[model samples]
Target: RSAGVSKAHDPRHAAKMFKSAQEDKTGRWLAIHFTSHDNPHISRDALEELIQDMSKQSYRQEILAEDDEIQLSWLVYRAFNERTNKIDDFEIPKNWLVYVGHDFGGANPAALFVAQDPATGNFYEFKEYLPGAGHSTAQHVDMFKELTTGYSVIWRSGGSHQEGEIRQGYSSHGWPIVEPKINSVKAQVDKVVGTMELNKVFIFKSLHNRLTEVMNCLWAPDAEGIPTDKIKDEEKYHLSACARYLYCNFTPDTVVHNKSRTSHSMSM
Candidate 1:
């Protein structure tokens, strides 16, 4: 009684199968199609993560539950909202923890500035700088210095092969960098998805490049109809890489503790 819409079994065929089942009249004919976002058991955060982990066609058919032509679909498409999540510039509280995440590549050297709100345990990406080709490491370093001049920040770098070079260059200029052991791609992606699902992540409206990259990042599906770890349209994944690094490595200083009275402490 279960059927999936695929190239071999199109929606028309699936519909025919449903009709045949309905004609049997032995049991109630019930059919439901929905994406993970529509599932009550999945939270918004989990759903977002699920989408990010899906391939282009998988997202279209599985998450969207739509019978349409499948093409490259965004991995983080469901995680962001321009109206609610994107905002105008705001001052970072002096007491808030600031973080800078870097993704280094010869073509694109990307950095993202994130501020954690201690009171709400939310993280906001307030700015991004993606300098495309022809920029030297020194130029990148200078830009980083100028961008983060006034803020006290914890600098974290993605484990690029060129990381040592980047570190040496920055350190020579007196910028301290920390390189945490990078987690598996799946792990980092899961963390980013979970964090966003809790409504704990935001972006600046003016960060058009970052937003565009997020919109374009998609998974390449394997032959088995599952999303492969391979990602596509990666010209902008650099900032996303920075985000993943920050979310995976940076621990918020604020922790919300729950208080409750034990049954033994209550009046019997």
Candidate 2:
């Protein structure tokens, strides 16, 4: 869709323009409106008209009513907006129990660091490591160690897609990584969804790479274009796999108030 050419559309030109937005995202001039039919500003007639028009294009994105112009066919994390919070200048107290979840990638390895608040039983993803390509396992271990220097990293684990050598590489280097206790993909997705619904998970805003993966985490589609349980673009969603590794490994027990625990709330 062009500025004034609704009937005559040029997709190639439109794609080129959109690609520019992706390249330099900081300064873009796109008038984005995120109002749904339930918006209070809409009159009854306007709402009815919007609904009627939406019914015609139910599966496609209603660009005028949403900010995400490209609607994900099957979004993986539905509770990402409501349950997750992002803060610019938040600090993790030294007392919080920290854990790292990792994914050994084909091109590059990635890790996500999460801290558990003993008092509220909430999990916060404070930092991430997703340096793309050419870095060795030893370097990744060193970077992770350096990142969580002061925090008490109780455990670190990941899924190497049954490639024992990759996990072995980390273990031999002294990181001592382990396989996830909850190994099933269904189990991992279920656990993440369950925890998110309970308001126990919050991902920091600083993790740009991780956040980008989360937004693009979509279920793979079948031959008939119906979304299936298998994830689409698995390579691009490596950090998302790290997220699945995270909640599966760190199952928070009932919040037993620790009097000595620092009051550094996971409140964004």
Give Cα-based local distance difference scores for all models.
Answer: 0.65, 0.68
Off by over 4 Å in 2: 1-73, 82-84, 250-268
Q: What is the TM-score of each candidate against the true structure?
A: 0.63, 0.67
In model 2, the worst 10-residue window by lDDT is 259-268
> What's the C-alpha lDDT at position 27 in model 2?
77
Q: 144-237, model 2: which lDDT tens digit per residue? A: 8899998888777788558667888889998877777677876787767766766777888788777766666777766644568987777677
Error of 1 at 153 (Å): 1.0
Count residue pairs with overlapping backbones in model 1.
Answer: 1
Give the lDDT of residue 233 in candidate 2: 74
Clashing pairs in 1: 45-197
Most lDDT-accurate candidate:
2
